[model samples]
Target: MFKDSVVIVTGGAQGIGKGIVHAYARQGAKVVIADLNEGLGQQLEQDLLAKGYSVLFVHTDVTKEEEIVHLMQRAVEQYGTIHILINNAGKFQHKSPYDVTFEEWSDLLHTNLTSTFFCAREAAKVMRHNAKGGAIVSLASTRAEMSEPDTEAYTATKGGIVALTHALARSLGPDQITVNCISPGWIETGDYAALRPIDHAQHLSGRVGVPEDIAQACLYLTNPQNNFVTGINITVDGGMTKKMIYEE
Candidate 1:
């Protein structure tokens, strides 16, 4: 469905973002991976190229506006236009609210929340000129609506992403650009083999989610036929949020 399409994914070096990069590339999209991790990003670029996939890795710190501009510029220079953008770069913090300094809070906000807005803005500039418009999907989390201790900063950024998705959808709707977010839960990016059966049982789907699950959601949201479903947040959490637990 994405033949020859130009797709740019921020933080597309590892974890869930890596899954997204592979998904788009497999569908024939010219994928541009924007990430700060040079090692992972460059390695991924080489690996995908080995499979004959078209991809470029741009070392970027999403929290910096200048780097984002450069990332977009580089993509447009190479691909001529951008058809899809996936904002997936973010930081996680777990400091207690009391101990969280202004610097820490501000840094997290810039990394997680501010970067999303700027990336969308820059991408939308190139997208607006497309004949059929474009699509943007961001990585949000279930923590946006629910939270645990020492999650204030992360939760706030996620909630902001949810809100930002709808707003961007409205603002860019005139140009036919669609915006959306996916909220994932318990996506075991590490050591899936180490998880006990009880961990899998916690989810209503009878298993934990993998990066591929969210990658599938991204494909659905950015599909050319599914533009009607914009400005919404899709929670890909294996129905964990729906489960009501009680003390045994």
Candidate 2:
């Protein structure tokens, strides 16, 4: 459905970001893989290109304003305009509020929240000028609603993202642009599965989520027909948020 549409997926080299990139590419969208990991990004680009998919890898440090600005410029230079943006780049290190260092807390906030704002600002400028408008989907987490131990920084940043999404939606709606956030819960990525096998099974689905589950929600939000759905934080947590399971 995204044929010829230009889509940007930050952190598109692996995990959930990779899944989103593949989904958009399969639908014939021109994809830009923006991330800090140059090697992985280049490899993914080459692999997708070999499969006859239109993709580009731009080594971007989302926390840097100059790099984010350059990434947008490169996207426009390569594909003319961006029709969708997936703000999937984030950092999640476990640390208690009392134990977390100042630098660590700052890094998490900068990477997860501030960077999202920077990229959205730049993309909205271009999308407004294009007059066709665009869509933005940010990766949030269910921790924004329910928190676990040592997840203070992550939870705080994710909550900020939900608020940011709503505010942006209100401001950008006048320009015909839509902005939303997707909150994933207990996803079974390789590292996460290895880290918390038991907690992963506590979900109402009796299993953890996968990258594709979140990607599917992203596709729906960014779809051309879903223009009316904006400023909402859709939770893809397998109903975990609905249950009141207490851990003793």
Candidate 3:
């Protein structure tokens, strides 16, 4: 557990980000929910506070460097120090490589790749000074390894994140900061009732992944005692990545 630790989760208002936020809050960490959606962010903040968990929601567009800097400043001001950062603020949108505009491609790169670097840079600034050091976990995707047509933009950024994770881990090793990335596959953020048989059968684990599967991995990677596990990519995709595909 993360008792009394200060943790920041970008895009923490919904989906996998929300699950990670809840997991940390349940373990007594003072969590900063940095998100773009004011309504959902505030609601989640209030909900956690009602349960007597310490949390603060700061509306932040992570693609902008200034907003990210301000968000970190706010977190440190409130919590005194940052102990962990989960860079999960990203969108999955794809277009045909032939039809993707320059603006669209730029936006995708900024959102998924640039934001990851900025957040880690800012968090490491604070963590390096802390005596206990800190940990960072980023969200990549399984699409980075295997992708469908027209997924070039999304795939490129995810692949970038995996490389970024290892590079950052090496740079921050002297400072005792661990950096890691998680690549998730086929995680259905919606109702489990809607899944078809193929969805269940395709994965070697016999089911598609849920947010909690990734969230649990987050907890393990960022745990202070697990300092030995760093610079690695954990694929929480129910063995789908390892399975071979052929026409039946």
Candidate 4:
């Protein structure tokens, strides 16, 4: 469905980002992997290229404004215009509020929240000039509403992203550029599976989600037929956000 479309996926080197990139590629979309991990990003690019997929890897620090601008420029240079942007780059750390240093908190905010804003703003600029509305999807977390221990910074950034998604959607709606947020629950990704054992019953779906689950949601939101689905935060957490599982 995305044939001839150019899509940018931040942090596209691995995990959920990789799934999104592969999904777009499968749909015949030209994929640009914008990430800071140069080695992994380039490797993914080469691998995808070998598979006869159109892909580009741009080493980008999303928190850096100049780097974000360059990322957009490179996408335009490679594909003429960007039709979709997936703000999937983020940082995760486990730390208590008391133990979290200022630097650590700032870094999380920059990586998770600021980067989304920077990328969205730059992409919106291009989409506006192109005179064709584009879709932007930001990856949020169910933790934004529910919380675990020692995740103050991470939760805060995610909450900000949820709010940011609506604001951007409202601001860009007049231009037909839809913006939405996907709040994923405990998805079983390579990193998540390595960090903890999967418990299917923990969520309402009787299992944790896979990266493809969130990617599919993103594809739905970004689909050209989904014009009325802006400003909404779709929770792909297997109904975890709706259940309150608190032990007293």
Root-mean-square deviation of each candidate, in angstroms?
A: 0.8, 2.0, 0.8, 1.9
lDDT values, one for every candidate: 0.95, 0.92, 0.95, 0.92
List candidate 3 segments past 4 Å from native.
none
Off by over 4 Å in 2: 191-201
Question: Tens-digit lDDT track for model 4 on 104-171?
Answer: 99999999999999999999988876566899999999888888899999999999999999999999
Error of 4 at 135 (Å): 0.3
Model 2, span 1-248: residue lDDT tens = 89999999998998899999999999999999999999999999999999999999999999899999999999999999989999999999897678899999999999999999999999998888766699999999989988879998899999999999999999999988999999998676686536565676677786788888998999999997999999999999988899976689
Better of 1 and 2 by TM-score: 1
| Model 4: per-residue Cα lDDT at residue 159 | 98
Inter-residue clash pairs, candidate 2: none
Candidate 2 has an lDDT of: 0.92
Would you give me the overall lDDT of model 4? Answer: 0.92
Q: What is candidate 3's lDDT per residue for 110-203, written digit by digit as tens?
A: 9999999999999999999989789999999999899998989889999999999999999999999999999999888899889999989999
Can you write out model 1's per-residue Cα lDDT over 9-101, one digit (the tens) per residue? 998999999999999999999999999999999999999999999999999999889999999999999999999999999989998999999
Worst 10 residues of 2 by lDDT: 192-201
